[model samples]
Target chain A: MKILVCVKRVPDPETVIKLTPEGASIVTDNVKWVINPFDEIAIEEALRIKEKAAGTEVVLLSIGQKTAQEQLRTGLAMGADRAILVLTDQVVEPLAVARVIEKLVGTEKPELILMGKQAIDDDSNCAGQMVAELLGWPQATFASKVVLGGDQKGAQVTREVDGGLETLAIPLPAVVTADLRLNEPRYASLPGIMKARKKELKEIPLAELGVDVAPRTRIVKLETPPKRTGGRKVGSVQELVQVLHDEAKVI
Target chain B: MIEWSEQHELIRQTFRRFVEAEIKPNLRELEHGDTPPYAILRKLMATFGIDQVARARFERQIAREKEGEAGPGERAAGPEAADSAAMQLIPVIELCRYCPGMVTALGVSVGLTAAAIMSRGTLRQKERWALPLLTLETIGAWAITEPGSGSDAFGGMKSTARRDGDGGYVLNGSKTFITNGPYADTIVFICKLDEGNEPRERKVLTFVLDKDLPGLTRSRPMLKMGLHSSPTGELFLEDVRVGRERLLGETEDVPARAGAKQTFSQERAGVPAMALGIVSQCLELSVDYARTRVQFGRPIGEFQLIQLKLARMEVARMNLQNLIFRQIEMAGAGKRMTLAEASAAKLYAAQTAMDVALEAVQLFGGNGYMAEFQVEQLCRDAKVLQIYAGTDEIQVSQIARSLLRG
Candidate 1:
């Protein structure tokens, strides 16, 4: 069995983001980049699959500048067999990313494509669906539980839905997008990191993928969310109820 | 000036996350709930594959020792060794930021005890005792300090290991302030050889003893001002008989006295990283408190005195960081600090950490003094740095003596 997990490097969620001087993008000078949290779950799921199925090859696939190699190495440390970096600094939109991944699918020929439902950076929630559409393959998005079938030809996937879970048995060569409730990722051990330094990390230029690589969207501006005002304390239950009923209108 | 590369930063971040996840939640249990730190420390070792690395390193050392080769030098050398050393210390620094006691307990078991056997013990001894210790499969205590011998370990020593009628040694002594003492499965007891020599110039011998041997008694943990997470206790040996095989080198020629100095040097060298952790945490908390603590219609940061305190904390942090970087760079160059140099590093780093922590408490006012605040714990923990391994006064004396001799 072969699994290809698409990962992204994003600014650490703990960082206090600040806008650039132009207010059109975030300031990246001192920002720490980490493997997207959801992507870590995807990697964890892939590792679990590899553990269950003998001779399974888990390859990490990412699209970004050279710095993304750090995230790739981190994935490798988490027990991926190898890594592929689609090297480019251009802001590739969801469609272009899906196209590039589509090109990789043709070469890697992995039986399953595993990835986070969306990267936390843009939260577009479009790339996986777009790739699934481009490839015309079935996809199970927001997967909370995935159990490979005994037959090795299909997998039972439980997905997080509105107020409930939806289960589906998807055949091989499907896309599974990880949800927050997916298996918790393990810490990359020190020995694993040292071994990862020796693993194979193959870099392919975006142009070599033979894709259009053009963005279909652009950001007009970036602004901070409005600051929340301090809440007022009511002296009595009646006063609290009156405030919630009249001023807040949410009794 | 040296800095962490991308790889080093990644390692630091990995350990930082592990600390936040594993240690932060159980901190209260460890600090005040009578829970020992060994279990958590072992879990950390397994989680990080430190045990695997340590086992492999020991195997290599064992093979080398069998081939009549010298062990690897104490100092790290080359980029690989330096990186490996830094990786080991990252957890020490990160853990100390939240709980210095964990690092203390871990260092004694793995660093001090394992290094003791690996460096001086014969191959058979290493296989019997050191391997388990390095892997943290068994806890170890290196007992050198006696109730009477705090600063003058040799001159004021009272413990003795005498040759008995059966050609074995009978050990008699008590060791206090022993790390991992209460729960140590194996102990490396250091004592003077009672060979009819003058007390001050007696030969120092090291014996490896198990926990429950006849006449060996370990006290329950004593109340400590800090480092409570690391159980500190006393060990009393009343004529505990041990065979020649139990001797560290199976000979008295390998003086335990010399090994204790080397161990002290290693311990002193590690102080900077621990100090850096505590100082940096204190500074960070102080900065956050300054920015939000309102007084006289403005944040306390607006006041010049508070600003000065914050500024000094920053200075101390910078200097400590640079000192640690220098140590790493030196290790990369395959250089080890002289005993005096290590002492100087410990002295300055310990003093700086103590000053910064005291100022942090002052900045927090009553809140800082209370147990609720982290700086209060940090302040108490930082004081041990000045006392243990060697006191600030001892470190100063060591540095001055080297200068005077030169």
Candidate 2:
């Protein structure tokens, strides 16, 4: 069995982000990049599956600039067997990313495709579904639980819904987008990091992928959210209620 | 020129994540509560595959020794030596930021005890004892410092090993302020051979002893001014009989002084990284406190006095970082620090850590004195750096002696 996991490189969530002079994009200088938190979950799920099933190869796929290899290497270090990085300096849109993944799926022929429900950087949350639609494969999004069937030909996935979890039994060669509670991802051990350098990380130029590598949307402007004012201490519960009712007008 | 590369930075980040998730939450228990740091240290080893690396390195070195090759120097000075040094020091720095005591405990176990054996122990001894210590599968204590022999470790030493009639020896010593002493599974006990000579004239011999050896008793952890996370204790051995196999290198002719001096150099060189952690943490805390701490209608950062403290901290941090970089660069060039050079670096680093921590506390004013503030803890922790691996006074003398030697 083969599991293909999609990952994205994003700025570390803890980093203090600064916007460019024109508010066009974030200042990339000095920013540390990491595998998207959700994507880490995806990789963790795939590795877990690989551990349980014999001869299961876990492959990590990422579509980004050459720098994204760091994220791919990180995934490989976390026990992914290999990686395929679709290299492009340009910002590929969700549909374009899906198309590229769809094309790779044809040649790679992985039995299962796993991805994060959304990339934390953009939070578009649509790429996995788009890939599923393009490939005409069943997909279980927001996967909180995944149990492989006895014969390994299918999986029972539990999705985190609005107020409850919904279970779906998806056939083989399915797409599964991981949710937050799937499992805590493991850090890349030192030996794993050393071995990752030797792991096969194959990179393909975006032009060779033969997908429409153009952005379908545009960002007109970006602005930092307004700073939150400090909250005042209320003397009593009644006073707090009165203040909230008068000032916030929502109580 | 030798800054952290992109890969190093990523490794640092990953280690930071591990520290945050594992060590940070249990810090209170480890520091103030009755928890020994071994479990967490083991987790760290397992998480980072440090034990595996140690095991592999140990096997390779032992294999070479078995083939009659000269035992490798303290570290392999190869292309990866610098990176390996960086790898070793990164954890020390990161651990020191929160718990300098943990670093002390870990260093004593792996760096001193295991290293003592690896450098001098015979091939069989290395396989029997040093391997476990290197992997931290067994905790180790290098017992050298006695209660009365802090400065005069050899001259005032009363510990002795007498040649018994059975071709074995009777070991008797009480080691004080021994790191990992309370719970060490393996102990490298250093004593002088008693050929009925003066203590000063006795040969300094080292032996590897098990914790369960009869007549050997370990005391409970001692209360200290700081660095409580690392358990320090005393070891009492009364007529403990051991065979020749327990003797490191199975010979009394091993240059014990030179061997110990090499270990001292390594320990001293590591101080800059530890000091960097403490000093950098203090500086960062001070800077943050200065920026937001309001006094006299402005942030305290607006005041020149606070600015001076912050600037001095920055200077110390930069110097310590450069010292560490120099150490790494030297290792890359297959060079090891002489005891005097290491002493100089340690002296500066230890003093700088102490000073910066003090200033950080001062900058926090009343809050710094309170235990809730981290600088207060750091201030206490920073003092030990100057005292251990030889005191500041000792370091100064070491450096001076090197300069004046004719």
Candidate 3:
């Protein structure tokens, strides 16, 4: 069985993001990039499945500039068998990214597809659903646990919902989007990092793929969140209650 | 010219993540509590597959030796050598940021003790002892310093290995301020061979000994001013009998002095990386504190006096980083620093770390004096960088002597 895991190269969560002058985009200089945390969990799940099933191949797929190969290499280093990077310098939206993955699904024909519920950068949370809709396959989003059947034809996914978890049994050739609690991703071992250099990382220019790489929604303006003011210490419970009722207006 | 590459940065980020998640939370326990650092160190080795890498390198070297080829002076300088150097130093810098003591314990075990054996041990000895140390399965201590010997380690000679007339020897010595002394599973005991000669003229011999042998006593962990995360103690050996097999290289003819000197150079070279970590952390913390700490209706950072301190820290950090890069580049070029050069680097790095840490504490004001703040701990840890490896006085003399000889 072959599993395809989609990963995105996002700015490190710890990076101090700076916006461009026009507020159109972030200043990219010196920004350290890492695999999206949820995507890392997705890759971990795929690797776990590959471990249980013999002859299982774990393939990483990413769509971004050539530099995204770094993230792909990271996934490969985490024991993925191979990687395919759809190279494009253009800013592709969720629908466009879905179209590209849908095209790859036709040729690669993996039994299962795994992706993060949302990219931390955009937080769209719709790419996996769009891919599943385009391919007309079953999808389990926000997956916390995934257990494959003995025959490898289906999987049971436990999803983290608003209040609790909801389990779903998805058929073969399904798409599953991982959530935060799915699994803690393992660090890439040194040998794995060394071997990742040798693994096959096939890159296809997005132009050749002939997909409509266009942005559907425009980010009108970006604004930094308001800075939180320091809270004052109340002398007593009555003062705290008075402040909460008068100033905060929450009580 | 020697900036970290993209891959190197990624490795650093990943290792930093591990340290934050695994080591940071346990800092209080490791520093103040009685927890030994071996478990965490072992986990680090396993998480990064450091043990496997060491095992693979050891096997390759041993294979070459068995084929009658000379063991190519440990690390061969090449394309991978640069990466190898970065890989080794990155952890040192990262760990030193929070716990310099752990690096001290780790270096003594893997860098010094294992290195002593791998450099001179017979193929049988390497297979028997060095491999475990390299993998950190067995903790190791390279015992050279004694109660009487600090800078004059060999000259104050007290430990002796007397020939038992049965092709074995009886070892008697006590090593003080030994890293990992309390819990080392294996020890590389350095002592003078007493063939009934004058103590000053005795031959220095290196022997590998196990932990639980008869007459071998390991003292409990000793209390120290700082670097409490790394356990330091004393080792007492009285008539500890061992066969000739325990002798490194299975021969006494190999000059142990030169090997020990090489170890000293390696240890000294590592100091800059550790200093970089401490200084980098101190500078970062100081900057944060300066920006937010208000003193007279304005942030302390607005004051020129504070700016000078911050600027000095940045200078020291940059210099230390450059020294580390030079070490890496030298490794890539298959060149090793002379002992004098290594000493100079260590001397500067140690002083810079101490200065930066102290400045950071001052910037934090009364808060810095309190244990609640990180600067207080770093200030204490920074002092050891100078004392260990070689004291500042020793480094100065070594550098001056080389200059005068030239």
In CAPRI terms, model 1 is classed as: medium
In candidate 3 chain B, where is summed lDDT lowest over 10 consecutive residues? B1-10
Q: What TM-score against the true fold does each predicted structure earn?
A: 0.92, 0.91, 0.92
Between which residue pairs do clashes occur in model 1?
none
Model 1 lDDT tens row, A67-163: 9999998888878999999999898888998998899999999999999999998899988898889999889999999999887789899999999
Q: List, residue by residue over B49-158, the lDDT tens digit for candidate 3.
A: 99999999999999999999889485677868988888899989999888888899899999999999999999999999999999999999999999999899899969
Single-chain TM-score of chain A, each candidate: 0.93, 0.93, 0.94
Interface RMSD of 2: 1.3
Alpha-carbon error at B100 in model 1, in Å?
1.1
Residues B122-196 of candidate 2 have per-residue lDDT tens digits of 888988998999889999999999988987788888899999978799999899999999999999999999998
- Proportion of native contacts kept per candidate: 0.63, 0.52, 0.44
The C-alpha stretches of model 3 lying farther than 4 A from their native spots are: A14-32, A65-67, A87-91, A162-166, A200-208, A220-251, B72-75
lDDT of 1 by residue, B1-406 (tens): 2677766776788888998888888888888837899888988899888899989988887787668777756444688867776887778889998999999999998889988988888888889999999999999999989999999888898999899968799999999999999999999989999988899888888889999999999999988888778889999999899999998899879967789899999999999999999988898899889988999999999999999999999998889888888877777888889999999999999999899999999999999998778898888889999999999999999999999998
Model 1 chain B weakest lDDT span, ten residues long: B68-77
lDDT (CA) per prediction: 0.90, 0.90, 0.92
For A89-125, candidate 2 gives per-residue lDDT tens digits of 8888899999999999999999999999999887999
